[model samples]
Target: MKYSRLSIWNIVVKCCMSWVILLQACNNSNEAIEFVSESYGEAEIISIDPKKDIDEEYSMKASLIVSSIDYFPLTLPGDMVIGEVAKMIHHNGYVYIFDRHTESIFIFTGKGEFINAIQRKGGGPEEYRDIKDFEVDRSSGNVLIYSPRSQKILHFAITGEFLGAINNKVQHTSFFPISDYKIAIYNSRLSNGHVFERTFPIQPRFIIANEAEEIEKQDLETAYREQLLMYPNSSFGFYQVGDSLRLMESINSVVYGVDLEEGRVYQRFAFDFTSANPPRLYDMEADELSTFVEDYKNKKVGGWASLHRVNETADLLHATYFYDKQVCRIFYSKNNKSQVNIGASWMNDMDNIPMPLVETTTNEGELLGYYGSDMLSMIVKHGKSKPSQRILDLEKSQRDAESIILVKFRLKDF
Candidate 1:
């Protein structure tokens, strides 16, 4: 693939990209590969930095991106109480929400009909003691949950029947099924990682493993932190962006594209936060790793940024990040090279009223957000700017209901 390339940069990008590493298998392989990270830094890829823009007010408005809004009021029965929405996934005409507190997955139809809940939280052979993370297998319609406590991946039917479990030797807090053979995992060993985090000084942050649980390959190390706390992030995980599976680091805005076929990982996008990243944890010396955690706890900064979600519509790329101590959402226009920034309440010009946060996104390329009952009531009753009759009718129909209303919207092409 490199030979047919025109420029040297293209050749470098094709075979062993700058940050794209080809690591040897962890246990039984000693085939060394050059870990080159400098040759192709952020200069080659597109940088979506909001600091470059002069406008303090967000350029992106609800009207510019939102073509239409949908309200799916979920009907909850007496047995079901969604304690917390830890993770949500929409697939095959159904919506699955994992409640971490309850250790259960609640299923619902696309149109807001209550279905079933997968509540198998036991120490049996089929049940998982705890769920680290879960992904709905697209090809087979099976629910794959990784339980680090049990060191296994349990498979369950979409309708909540236990199929079986796969023995996993690899240490991962969360995993994304690349194919039947390939799986991309977020390494469990971080500075403040959860239960299964090892005390070893060095640990891989990401790994590619097989169904048998043996490591095929791994990349990036977690040697900077003083692994003492318990903070496991299943957010900013292996999410579908377009046709590719993207992995975004929690501390910074560097996103990687995972190749399912070659078991390769490469940098695809980065947000320029020069003031936030330089001279920090990654650059600390071996001796500094000892006291760095305590120092990091006390040290505060104004320029720090961490990406929360990166999703897109056909024409606009949406990204939400914590920048300079404020939560920001920016929509970058693909056609005009413009950016719209909104801090809260997307300017729902269609309704001539404010809408709640449009944060979560579905795999079908639609934005999924929500509004609690109290807030929605305030918007309808208190806002001086009245909503359009269509939006008013939608809210009025569910006015009496006391539940969180899910807002599913598609961005306009313009």
Candidate 2:
């Protein structure tokens, strides 16, 4: 298969230069309001410093208090094993697990009883060749699956009944339903052709489309195409909290909160990296950018950024960044103006017993995380000589189970 051998370094430099010129034009035209950051209120900046040891000053009480750990013994009828769950959605007393390996969506009750698998993969009518993404409509109880190969959105009921399909004119990577009549679509890569070629220079990263028309669009400050090409897997992060949709660029420190109803940036959360502020694409010269990229490749300076979870009620944000071959978590508290740098020791905790919930899967109101079945099996076999009653019970129950365990946590009210 032939691939585009375009040098990423050259593309980044060109995109950055183009972005600077576009910003200047927008600033002069009095149209910067559409792109400029609006204030909800200044967020208390929390700076997490890198350290070899867990600094006592930064270490405070664990932000999340584990409420309960539940295990769902998946009771699939046949030889179907729950493959690696790529995405999970806990909605309306049911857990929706999207398994990418099998290209199937499996539904289970809140208590872990197998309900049914959604329509199978096929090329027939109402069937999908591939499911790029999916969203559950709580109001209508419909599961909307986006198939890139077919370029259509397949709608189905919770019970696996096919409803219909919506023709997707715009090849969006993912979508979120804002209302019954509207959706917010995200496109990370620029399409090829004359229309897209002409508009590619100023195309927005996201679009708000109704049943009939596109109502609004917003462009990002960073070079979207360059970043998408550089870090294909970890380019953008999207989280929905209540009525607000949060968007964050993996290479940037700011998290923008957009109003779901209006589809505009309403608030922003900035992280104080202090001396370690990442090199902005628009600010670095060619030589400087080359050195920066080289350093990153050699594991010398900056690392890729991933926002793992965000808790609105606790005013807390959890993220991980890799530097010098070590992955560290940034625990930031928005209300108290404090930050913690948790190293591997803290992440692994005492006796190398994995913390109850160190990674998050979804964040609706509180953070929802899980322990994989493989991790549980290892803990059961080699954890401790005298395990706690909870650990013992968890191990015993999961001895014959092939399901992942779930852990829910909420911010501790100080």
Q: How does residue 109 of candidate 2 score in lDDT?
A: 72
Highest lDDT against the true fold, candidate: 1
Error of 1 at 342 (Å): 2.3
Per-residue C-alpha lDDT of model 2 across residues 275-356, encoded as one tens digit per residue: 4444454345546555544544444543323333343433667765443333455566666656566553232221223444
Give the Cα error of residue 343 in candidate 2, in Å. Answer: 2.4
- Clash count in backbone of candidate 2: 0
Error of 2 at 141 (Å): 3.8
TM agreement with the true structure for every prediction: 0.76, 0.74
Candidates' RMSD to native: 13.0, 10.3
> Which stretches in model 2 have alpha-carbon errors above 4 Å?
1-44, 52-72, 169-173, 189-197, 212-215, 221-228, 232-235, 282-315, 345-352, 356-365, 384-386
- What TM-score does model 1 achieve against the real structure? 0.76
